[model samples]
Target chain A: DTAVSQTPKYLVTQMGNDKSIKCEQNLGHDTMYWYKQDSKKFLKIMFSYNNKELIINETVPNRFSPKSPDKAHLNLHINSLELGDSAVYFCASSQQKTTTQETQYFGPGTRLLVL
Target chain B: DQQVKQNSPSLSVQEGRISILNCDYTNSMFDYFLWYKKYPAEGPTFLISISSIKDKNEDGRFTVFLNKSAKHLSLHIVPSQPGDSAVYFCAADDTGRRALTFGSGTRLQVQP
Candidate 1:
């Protein structure tokens, strides 16, 4: 059983296409995050949701939107894809910890290729 | 601007030796540090972490050392095995912020 999972492990599409990547966590976490690993292999935070509410939105493009229907699910929708958007996206979950540091569990990344 | 930096892009070590990976951060607000190991085609796995209050934390054969003054941290793997070969990432977080800033990963290869 996967603690965190994403659908369409591999996505190949042409530029200007619209696609969505779905993420789910079964670990009963209240916080979820989306990270993009660019060609340089730097994992940067795109968005974060806590208890199904938007909390952190980095300086990402407007085309990328994140929606959390519930605490267990967070989905990312890209309006118009571009060749520069080709990268591996990862979803992670963590139980909010204020006393000590909390560890984030990640799901198998979805490698998106835009031709 | 890259807040976190991993100077070494790749590292190689012999089996049964020690492997050290270094990371430096420019954000002084970051008080919590973590190390994550990732293999190709897989997500990063939580390895170990240390709070700014402490200088070191260890689990199994993995140990993490932090120097707040230097704004630097390092991960040490003792008796490095071939299975330990993977990309190691160093992450830093602020005291209250749950978001993490990750450094450019260092690929470690343990030769047999």
Candidate 2:
């Protein structure tokens, strides 16, 4: 069974289209994160949510937003998508309770193609 | 600026040999370091980790060495098998933020 899962394993869209990627974790984790892996294979964190609350927001553009309806789910919506935004998006989850040793679990990435 | 760096884009090793992957970081606040393995079209899976307080950690044939003073770390796999082939990413855990900063992954190919 997959502990973390993401929808739309592959997405092909044109520029200026708005799209959403949904993420869910069945590992009963309290923290969830969204990361983008660019063409260079560099992975960077975009946002983090703790118990359905926004905890960390990187220098990502405002057009990108993360919604956490609950601790088990975190969805990313991109508005006015650009060609530069075409990349693999990964969703991850971890259990954190003041411990510095928690490892993150990641979902199979969604490869978005901006045509 | 990139905080974490994995200079090598790829590495190749023969079976039953040693494979060493190196990573360097500029952020001194990172208290924990981890290695993740990723195959094509799949998400990364955690392989091993080392705390800043400790210099080394090992499990099975995989071992991670951390050098806080040098701000460098390396993952060593002895008797590398073809099954161990994958893209290896070096990540650092931001102490208070609880977020990980990952480096550009290095693809490791263990030839049979």
Candidate 3:
């Protein structure tokens, strides 16, 4: 069984269009996070949710919104996607809301291409 | 600016030999350090980790050494095999922070 899974492994879209990436974790974790790996191969955290509560909000633009309907699901919705948004997005989860002691499990990334 | 850094982007080693990956950090608030391995088109998988209180942690052929004084850490893999080839990431986190600061990454290739 997949501990964490992401839908639509590959996404190709046009600029100014909108897209959404969904993530689900079966590890029964209470914390979930979204990270983006840019062209430079830098993995940075964009948002984090703990038991459906927003916790970590990075300096990401307002166009990108993250919603967590339940503790097991976290979805990222990108509005007005730009060429610069072409990158790989990953979802992760941990047993606890904090990472000081637990390891975070990650899902297969979603490769997005904005044309 | 990136708080965590992996200066070496790639490394190659012969099978049955050892592979050492280095990482450095500039943040003092970080209390835990972790190593993650990622295959192509996949997310990173947790490999090993070390706490600031300890200087060394070993699990089988994989060992992680941390030097808090220099703000540096290294991962050593012994008798590396072809299956060990992958991109490794170094991550750090603070006590209360929910996110982990990651280094760019170091790709390791073990030739058989």
lDDT of each: 0.95, 0.96, 0.95
Spell out the clash pairs found in candidate 2. none
lDDT string for model 1 (B11-37, tens) is 999999999999999999998899999
Given candidate 1, what's the lDDT at residue B88?
A: 97
Candidate 3 i-RMS: 1.1
Comparing only chain B with the true structure, the TM-scores of all models are 0.98, 0.98, 0.98
- How far residue A108's Cα lies from its native spot in candidate 3, in Å, is 0.3
What's the count of clashing pairs in each model shown? 0, 0, 0
Candidate 3, B6-91: lDDT as tens digits? 99999999999999999999999999899999999889999999999999999999999999999999999997999999999999
Q: Write the per-residue lDDT of candidate 3 for residues A43-92, one digit (tens) a residue.
A: 99999999999999999999999999999999999999999999999999
**Which DockQ values do the candidates obtain, in the order shown?**
0.82, 0.86, 0.82
Q: Which stretches of candidate 2 lie over 4 Å from their true place?
A: none
Candidate 1 chain B — worst ten consecutive residues by lDDT sum? B92-101
Ranking by DockQ: 2, 3, 1
lDDT of residue A91 for candidate 1: 98
Worst 10 residues of 3 chain A by lDDT: A95-104
lDDT (10s digit) by residue, model 2, range A16-102 = 999999999999999999999999888999999999999999989999999999999999999999999999999999997786578
Candidate 3: TM-score?
0.97
Instruction: For each candidate, give the interface RMSD after superposing the true interface residues on Cα.
Output: 0.9, 0.9, 1.1
lDDT: which candidate is best?
A: 2
